[model samples]
Target chain A: MSAIYKRELNAYFTSPIAYVVYAVASFFAGLLFVATVLEGDTSDMTYLFRNMTTIIIMMIPILTMKLFSEEKNKKTEQGLLTAPVNLLQIVMGKISAAVTVYALLMVLFIIYALIISFFVTPSWVLIGSNILGLLLFGTTLIAIDTFISSLTESQVIAAILSIGAGLLLTSISMFKNMVDIDFVNDIIDSIEMMGRYENFTLGMVKFSDVIFFLSISVLFIFFTIKVLERRRWN
Target chain B: MIEVKNLVKKYGDKVAVNNVSFTVNEGEILGFLGPNGAGKSTTMNIITGYLSSTSGTVTIDGCEILDDPKGAKSKIGYLPEIPPLYQDMTVKRYLEFVYDLKRVTLPRKEHLAEVCKVTKITDVYGRVIKNLSKGYRQRVGFAQALIGNPPVIILDEPTVGLDPKQIIEMRNLIRGLGKKHTVILSSHVLSEIQAVCDRIVVINNGQLVADESTEEITTNFTGMKRIQLHIDGNDNTVLMTLRDVDGVTRVRKVMRTIDGFTEYIVESKAENDVRKAIFRAMAKVDCPIVMMRNAEVSLEDAFLRITAGETQVNRKGGR
Candidate 1:
């Protein structure tokens, strides 16, 4: 697992996707920080975290697009598949590599928050809670994108489809409000990724919400492993 | 040692490998000979545990692939048809990754050095694999397969797209490896297998057609004894005389000269020595037998005959 993780992490750096996504994502984060919080007198880190949740809808796909698709497309999966390592090890290696990069992106947000400290005193609890929520949220997004990447051999298709899935998951909160049916609204509110995250933004870190995000991540990773095994048999 | 028994692989409705069984003893080089889409790769894939077989089992060094994949896979090194390289990585890094993936217990640096030396890729070890030429990339692939010094190595068409010089080098490398490891390689090129393998297993249309030693297959195929004759006579007269000769099953004129001499190839009914009979018949017809020699069946002809569904005839003389 470590071997695959190291190789995958190196590949992310060698390929241009890592740098491109970092530049584009950091640029958007800086733009949003300056336009919304810096230009105004108040400093609500929730706005920054909310925008980040949206930013990852576009950025997480770029990070996880080539995870399995590139290996399958290039036929490099033969080497990995024939080795002594099992399928779950390979999947975890790839997921952790993406998470490592996502963690780095979140660290960069620290710099944005530190810069905000220069103008006004921001609530440290809000910043910490929101960052925790974003990390869990980004991990779930990466896991979902990783599964999507496993479904196809073309990285472009993987990226496009993952972005579409991320959009749907984030948009579930909007659907919950737009619907008039009580049962439908309750179901959507329970399943919506951002709906669960709203508690964290309100400075309440609930154990159930953390478990919800983690469960979704594992479910998707499990699905990806099943896809790989099915491919071998068929 | 590696043993595959009654292996069957199906890709949906297509049976890629049907009840294929073969074994490679220790320190032996087994050649898999077949045409394109002949189930050679599919069989190799199943044996290496890359693809699951519909039925049957592959055991390497007494460990079943499906039951104990880690044990079986650790004993074998595989090079697929395309080399399965990480093109973006430097050759050295790619090999290091393979070493870790294989979980080699040997000293890492020395094992890598030995592999590089054997494959003759030490010079380009630091270069990116994508930037190397095809031959160099192939050599790099070979280098990784040697890492950890696995006891069994499976190579699929190792010399498919190489130049003649590189092909010879690669063959020599594989031959050298045979002294220490069991090797199974697949190729459609008849001469390549003839020069490398201790035993040959021929598969055609998803079935094992022939499995014997290199010499056995060649000699069995040569059972249809043929003689090339240079007779001093008219083309049609020499052909008819040879055709009528006792033990001569068929005769065809190969070339005719303006000075009333002709060349003909005469085939016998079975594995008979038809040289003396042809000489005596030529003397009787007053047509001097200028030259006569047995036509040997090359491995190319043998492969064609076996793949063309003539297994029974070839099997008669081969054990």
Candidate 2:
């Protein structure tokens, strides 16, 4: 797992995608921060968190586009699979590597908060909560992207599907109108990733929301491994 | 070192490998020969634990791959048909990643050094694999399989896309690996199999129909032996006269324009030697038999007969 993690993290920086992801996400997040904090007379950072989610969606695809898709395409999957490690170790290693990059981006965002603390005033509690939310939210996105990347051999297809899946999951709150159907509305709100994110950004630690995000991430990671395992037989 | 039993891999309704079973002893080189999509890749994939079998069991070095995958997989090293490689990584870096993933003992710098020496790619190790020639990339791939010092190595078409010189080099490298590990080299190339393997496993239409020593498969699969006869006579009458010989299964004209005479090719039953009879028969026909030679079965003929019969006969473990 450590080996795979190092390899993936190195790949992120070796290519231009890592810098591009950070530049694009941090740019818009900074703008949203100024508008929500100054013009709107609010430091709630709900808007900041919302923008961070969007950044993650677009950037995570670029981050994970090469994970398994490129391996399969380049025929490097044989090298990895034939190696002595188990499937779980390999999958976890790749995820950890992507998460490391995501963590680096989060650290950059935290630095932005530190700058805000010096210039105006930083809500450390809210900032702390947001970081936690970012980790949870980032992992969820990475899990989805990783799974999508594993499903195809084409990087373009994997990237597009990951972006689309991220959008779909984040937009689950749109189905709240189905409150007319009590059960359906309950399920959507429970699975609603953005709805769950609101609590983390607001500095309220909700156990159910935390568990839901992690659960979703774990579920997809397991699915990705299963998809990979099935490939051996066919 | 490897055992496969009743292995059947199906993609939906289409079977890729059907009821394939074979064994490889320690330090033996087993060759898998088949046509394209002949399940050569699928079988290798299953044996290496890359893909789960639809219905089968694979045991490597006494450990079942499915029951204890990590244990079984650790003993096996597979080079897939395409030499799956990460192009962006340097050859050495890629091998390093393979070593890491293979979980070799750390701090054993000597093991790593020895593998590079064996593959003879130390000079090219520092360069990105994307920039290396296909031959070098293949050697680097072989180097990856050699990591962890696994006891079993399975190489699928290891020399598929190489120049003639590189192909020979790759064969020598594989043969060297065979001395230390149980190696399975899968290819449709007949000479590669005949040259490198101790035993041959021939599969056709996803079935293991022939698994025997190379010579045994050659002798049994090609049911008839071939002979070349140079007859001092006109083409038509010599052909007619040889066709009537008792032990001949087939008679064909190998050449008629060599020196203004016909050269007949006679295929006799596998167990029968009709050379002396044809010699005397030609003498009596007043058509002098200048020279007669029997042609042993080649790997090409063995592969064709085995694969062709695998589709047609559906034989049940006929020894």
Candidate 3:
């Protein structure tokens, strides 16, 4: 597992995906922060993470796009598949690596907070709650990207499809108001990623919201592992 | 050391490995022979627990691959056809990573040193794999397969793209490994297997066509006893005389004007060797035989028969 982790982490940076992901997300994040909160008079850290959730949705695919897809495309997955390690170890190692990169991106949000503190007092409870929300949101996005990566061998397709799917899930809340059916509205709102995240970003930090995000993340990761497991027989 | 039973792999209606079964004894060097897409690599993959067999089982040292993959895989070291390298990594880093993946129990540094010493990659360890030649890349692949000193080594076309010198070196390395490890080397190149393997298993269309000791299989598959004749008489007379010999099945008089003597390639009937009768007959015809030899059946001839002359397509292209 450690071997896979180290190799995958190094590959992310070596192949330039990690740097590209960090630069693209952080640059747009920087711009969003400056335009919305940094340049504005009032500062809401939760407001900043809420806005950056879009950036996370867009950029998570780059971090996880090649997790399994590129390996299979390049035929190097044979090396990992034939290794002494089991499939769970391989999937978990890659997921952990993607989470690590995602965590690094969230750390950039801290820099945004520090700059905000220069103008206004930084609220500890507000910042703590926002960071927790950011972690849950980032983890779920990474898990979605991981599942997308397992679905295709072409990394580009994986990235595009994941971004498209994530956009749908993120805007599921908006679609609920647009649709007239009551049952559909309730189902859509319950499954809406941002709907569950709205409470956390609003500093409520409900246990149910945390559990929803955690469960979705595990469900997607479990699905990705199953996709990989199916290859042995196929 | 390894047992594969009724193994079958089907791709829709096309069977890749169809009910193939074989066993390798401990410390035996087995060779897998087959033409392109004949399921040699697929069999190797199933044995190494890389791919699951559709409807059968493989037990490596008593641990079934499906039941205990880690235990079974720990016993077998595999090198696929393409070497499965991370082109970005240097040889040392790549091998160290493999060492970790194999979970070598010895101290990490010591185990690495042992692998380097055995594979002779210590000097070139710092070179990036992409920068290295194909031969070096192959060696790096072999080094990884040898990392944990597994009892069984499964190499698929190990010497595929190597030069003559590297080919000899790899063969010698595998031969040396046969002293301690049960090695299964698969190749379409019969000479490669003939040089290294103790036993040979010929597979075609996913079926085990033949399995025997290397010499036994080659000799059995050759089917003809060849007699070379250096006759001083006319080629036509020698040809007719060979036909008159009771056991001679067929004769091809080789066209060689070497020092004004003739050579004949007289193939005997499957179970007959009429060398003594031919010698006596040649003496009677006053065509004194200068030299004679029974052409031993080569591994190449055996492989040609195994692939059913499909390899003759190469000759057609050459022509």
Candidate 4:
């Protein structure tokens, strides 16, 4: 598992994808920071963290689209699957590598808060909670996108499908409002990812929300392993 | 050692491999001979635990592939049809990654260097795989399979895209590997298998057609031996003399050369060597034989005959 993890991490840096992801992420995060912190003259990072979720939704597919799809395309998955490693190890190694990259991006946000600290003292607890929330959210997105990547051999299709899934998960609240039935609204409210994330933006670390994100990540990672296993029989 | 029993793999309603079974003893080079789309790769994949057999059992070094995949896979190193290489990595990093992936206990630098020397890719060790030529890339793939020094090495069409020189080099490399590791190599080229394998398992349309020693398949599968002769004599006397020779089934004039030599093709029973008798008869009749050579029955002929339902006869007659 460590072997695969190290190789995957090196692959990200060797290619141009990691830099492109960072550049795109920094562009959006910088834009939001300038608008929310400088023009509004506020030390509060709630608005910036909240808006970064949308940027993450758009940028994470780029980091994960080639996770499994490129392996299948180049026929390298045969090597990985035939190696002396279990399916869980392969999945975990890949997801951890992508998460590490996403975590590095989150560190960029910490730097933004540090820059704001010079003017007015910012709450470290709030920043820590927001970073933790973003990390969990980004990991869940990576797991989901990696599963989508495993289902297809083309990276473009994987990226498109992942972006579609991310947008749908973020917009579940809108669907809940559009429906009038109480039972259907309750179901949507329970599954809405963006709503659970709002508590973290306000510096609240809800345990249930944490469990929800972790469960979703585990479910998708399990599905990805199943898809890979089923492919061998096919 | 590897044992495959009643292996059957089906993709939907189409059967890719049907009740195929064979074994490779230690230190033997077993060649899987088949044409395209003949499930050669599928069988290799199943043996290496990359793909599952719908109904079968593959045991490698006492470990069943399905029941104990890690144990089975740990003893086998596989090189698929296309060399699975990470294009973004340099050769050194890629090999180090494979070493770690295989969990080899040997000293990393020495093992990798030895593999590179054997595959003759040490000079290109610093370059990225994407920039290497097809031959160099294939050698790197071969190097990857040798990292752990597994007991069994399975290669599917390892020399598919190489040039003539590289093919010979690859054949020599495989022969060297067979000294220590039991090797299973698959190829459609008859000469490649004939040159490298200790035994050949001919597969046609996903069925095991013939499994015999290299000499047995070449000698017994032909059924009839043909000898081409060029003689400088009267055509009538040459034909009459050759006809009286024992075990000579048929004799006919093929062509007349510009130098007054007549060419004749003589067919005989497979077990007989009628060359001496023909020479004596020709000498007695004063028909000087200019040249004589046996016309070998190629692998294509034997393959076609076996695939055309002569397997039962060949199998019974061969051993």
lDDT values for all models: 0.87, 0.83, 0.84, 0.91
lDDT of 3: 0.84
Encode model 1's per-residue lDDT on B2-98: one tens digit a residue: 9898899988899999998888899999999999999999998888888999999999999999999989988989999988899999998999999
Which prediction has more favorable lDDT, 3 or 4? 4
lDDT of 2 by residue, B60-168 (tens): 9889988888899889877777777777888777787777777788554677778889988988878998898888878887887888888999898999899999999
Name the lDDT value of residue B200 in candidate 1.
Answer: 92
DockQ of each: 0.72, 0.61, 0.62, 0.69
lDDT of 4 by residue, B288-307 (tens): 99999998766776766666
Give the higher-TM-score candidate: 1 or 3: 1
lDDT of 4 at A171: 89
TM-score of chain B of 4: 0.79
Per-residue lDDT value at B61 in model 1 = 98
Candidate 3's residue-wise lDDT over B1-319, tens digit each?
Answer: 8888889998778899998888888999999999989999999989988788899999999999999989988888889998888888888878888888888887878888877877777888899899989998898999889888899999999999999999999999999999999999999998889888888887888877777777776566577788887889977778888899988876877766577788887777568869889988888888888889888766676686666743222111001
Quote the RMSD, in angstroms, for model 4.
5.8
In candidate 1 the C-alpha lDDT for residue B121 amounts to 94
Which residue pairs come into collision in candidate 4?
A: none
Clashing pairs in model 2, backbone N/Cα/C closer than 3 A:
A75-B84, A75-B85, A76-B84, A76-B85, A84-B102, A232-B51, A233-B51, A233-B52
lDDT of 2 by residue, A1-71 (tens): 89999999888888787899989888888788788865676656677786788888888999888899998
DockQ of 3: 0.62
Off by over 4 Å in 3: A177-183, B221-245, B248-298, B309-319
List model 1 lDDT by residue over A93-171, tens digit each. Answer: 9999999988888877688778878987778888888888988999999999999999999999999999999999888
